[model samples]
Target: MTGHGSGDLRERPRVLVIAEAANPEWVSVPLVGWSLATALRDVADVHIVTQVRNREAFLRAGEVEGESFTAIDSEALARPMWKLGEALRMGQGKGWTMMQAVAALSYPHFERLVWKTFGADLEAGRFDVVHRVTPLSPTAPSPLAAKCAGVGVPFVMGPLNGGVPWPKGFDAERRREKEWLSYLRGAYKALPGRRATLRHASAIITGSRHTASEVPDAFAEKCVYIPENGIDPARFSLVADPQGDVLRACFVGRMVPYKGPDMLLEAALPLLKAGRMRIEMIGDGPMLPGLKAFAEAEGVAGQIGFHGWLAHERVQEVMAGCHLLSFPSVREFGGGVVLEAMALGVVPMIVDYAGPGELVDARLGIKVAIGTRAEIVEGFGAALRRAAESPQALCRMSAAGRDEIAARFTWARKAEQVREVYDWVLGRSEKPAPFG
Candidate 1:
């Protein structure tokens, strides 16, 4: 088990999946990383390469370290650097500027470890491809792109996402979030290996229009847009059955300024006060106290359920009981919860701007156009009122959203799409038509 199988040269292409963050015990980027890596197995023979931190969890999940996945013991270099960055970050995302620096330091070691262990096999054509599937952050450069190209093995990067700019007129929110280095976010285009990675990559998959546009014009041909989020249909086994007579709406996300949880409350106040609708506010963050107080002050607290930060499964259960997921995050990157809601047949109402905006069209759910904070709040309220009053219309949207998810947004579907890309890269097929 100390070595890997070089996959039969005539069989399915062997792929090395690199995801430093991939671990089943974790959530967020790690969950996406792990899921995507595992999903690739249905289409290609794959060996995942990840960090030492994920080893125990990987083993617990039934993976044999050297064979199924390569656990790169890079913590000696990664942990200290992470600690230093966290200290400097000081609980402020600051547009993720500090973390990008930390990533610049740590991510390379992951690539180095991969090459150190498998460079010989790669050189001998043991694997047909190398795909770096994590650090989903586009800012993190993969030194392996150049290395892979040098040996004639195609390298693919991304589903890289991030850098969605804040909606206009939210400077206060920007400062509140300690986005000090936001102004220089554009400087990432100048990172030492960024351009080369794009230039040499066999393909670059982007998760958002913002991320797609980040690729330079010259490398645009290689850029492909595929959302970085998907749902496990089993997690949303709750049929679209309502719990009560009132058409309930739910908002699930961190109670942060950018997330617009306050806007959900402000928008739903009229319906919540009238007993025509109920609200379930899930998840917790710095904005929780204020959101609770705001509901009480507006006299709609009785109609709203404040269940802060439920487990993922519980969140789905709560979502199943509701008719819609109302999210107004101005800077959302994935609107992942929205997809989960859709998978459960709960329609979503999201601000039409960044990630959520791109995902929702007239068919999926509601898109509240981006505008001044006041305008967005008013638009969300109107959307809530409309959905609350019309059961038939809301049901139609719910069915359509779930159908859309089942048809195009599941991991199974994404892997098939990725398979298409592989065919294109290997000359087994022509460039794929754009994702519909």
Candidate 2:
């Protein structure tokens, strides 16, 4: 087996990573960036160019020794007046805007702009490979990969989720499906650069086999299955706290419309009413106002605690106290918090959606079916009830969850797998086989 810091001549490949953001504090993309940086450090001089959302938090997190960091100012992309006009147009079109439509149609032009700006840096030939952690964002042009291709640099695009169709048995309702079709049409209309992007990429990293199955047929051959996010097992271990009375269940991550935080609340409300569990929501987002209102209306306000925007370490501490982590997002690539909780022996209860379902096996955690809103609510409610009634079962699941992480999902292991991809891209004969 190759050691972490072998520094053999076969190692030390120079690579550049481009993403919208790359802070550990920035959720999914950052988690991907951090893990990749750490994994590739021994084998590559990794340089990450990403948008900086929070400058201080990013700086304080420090850098991976063999990795270099560059912050791309994306404030230029967030033109408020332009956004206002776009929003007005979208409202006029029934939540669909013409600018977005135009953007989609002119995606090639957008990709050109990205190349003009970031391509010059890569043209210097300092890096052998270019990896984009997240693709399909308007903010980061896919054409950048094409630029890398022009410079003879292998471009790896990925860890992409959400854009792909949901897995089988997890279909959206008719109404939602219609809405999704409209959104897909708009996406195609708005992002013309996708084909060119895929054409230039040497490989595409997907979070799971489920996501890999959704890769465009043209690029399907180049798709590689890799968990886009991971946890440091040493930092997050199974240290059960016996004194905590409330079987505290926590949900952490951005509170967005599709994230399904409200579903978790709805499921927990009846359990709280029955005096079965206490809930702690340790994140903030647009859904907070409505979720808070719903909690009050359900008369379970006292049983729920909302901790808005806790830092990453604070979140780990919160996970330590919690008995289970509940995430009911309709769309996700990989749930970083799910792995974090599992590493800490907090069994996960996730919606049977893309990311969580892929990560949470029966031994490690529970998966609730997600069909309709009512079905989601009922499924989660039943899981919560089962967890509340069986303390021993929770403990068993928690232990299994930690063991699973140690056996299969550590950053070190994930890094080794990624190094194999790097070796394959380098035209080496000693390529590691595709993960089963």
Candidate 3:
């Protein structure tokens, strides 16, 4: 009881943070893991536990290995599992569900090692709480949850954001991405440790409403909604200022089917042809060549700038010059790009579903209704025209988006919100409602 509840009376709680995928040098989930874990240091007495692979990055970032953090070497099982996942996934950027399925098999080894390494300290109350901040997929169950609960040490899991069902009209896109396993994704709920993981966790942080909805009604009271993605204001220091009759819109994602790069192109075709809007496409993928051909064939190539992948700074520079982040991805679990764009005072125009839908509103940004491909194109097209017609209103939304991100969506703010959850699970305060 040293650090638990009303025992120690320390200003900051002591937390052992588990983030298997944390790496400062990486992107997506790894970057998210690194950011959130490090940010939590500001609000807690923190010790990070990550995989052996991220040890070098942690050292480079000034984290003293074995002091500030500990690296669990589960490579004996993890490396082969990852290679098998790669082999079965069919291609890069496809078969995401297959990869996660493989990961679920290997992650238990990591957690087992964690308990072996830290179990005694946990039972002795060396740390106030144990938080798992990575493997954000809802399908991945944590064995540590039950272990911590058994020890009277609170366990917090997630901002878990994945498992958003594929929309009604995008089966073709799903198939193209080799997501065959997605059809059976629901079966994870019946997996052995899932119920115990939810049942034993002191707090469950749902990263999106869809993920929140996935938590059964029986455990609803302990669930808290806080998106896994957050903006680093330093990286997005530039501000966008679009000053012209033509709408300056940008799309920042993979040029793939579900991302709807083609849909965005088709939607903005009339605007591009009429010289009323210019689009900057800022990523590369299998669809790039086809998109190029379509733009050239439509005679709108001049209005669309196709910049294949750029460095993060360069991407921000491109987004900073634009007025809107027009992303139409239909199946994002965490719309990190939308947050990045909003941080730069760039209003987002995204399809209203999953992560992006939960992030935006009429006050900060625009949301197109989720629908079939044709309907999405029409929706995006009309949204583009309306934005063009009301440039001043768009500018106001841009500023509002930046303000909203600063207040509620930065990593620092996210860490504080998480601290509130820590307080609740530790019995120092009541359960937290971070957003409300």
As for candidate 1, its clashing pairs are: 283-309
In the predicted model 3, the residue pairs found to clash are: none
lDDT of 3 by residue, 1-436 (tens): 1111222234788899999999989889999999999888778888899999999999898888777899999999999999999999999888999999999988999999999999999998899999999989988889999899899999999989899899998999999999999999989989888899999999999998888888999999989999879988878889897667788999998888999999999999998999989999999999999999999999999999999999888999989888899999999999999999999989999999988998888888999999999999999999998888866778788889888898998999998899999999988888886573
lDDT agreement with native, every candidate:
0.83, 0.67, 0.90
Candidate with best lDDT: 3
294-410: candidate 1 lDDT, tens digit per residue: 888888889889999888779888888888888888888887888888888888889988888888888889999899899999999888877777755778888888889889888
RMSD versus native structure for model 1? 2.4
In terms of lDDT, the poorest run of 10 residues in model 3 is: 1-10
Is candidate 2 or 3 superior in TM-score? 3
Where does model 3 exceed 4 Å of error? 1-10, 434-436
Once fitted onto the true fold, the runs of candidate 2 whose alpha carbons sit more than 4 angstroms away are 1-9, 51-67, 70-126, 136-141, 164-182, 185-191, 233-238, 242-246, 254-257, 286-299, 430-432
Instruction: Report clashes for each candidate as comma-separated counts.
Output: 1, 7, 0
Tens digit of lDDT per residue, candidate 2, span 191-275?
A: 4556677778787777777656655787777877776667776567546553444567888876755667888888778788877
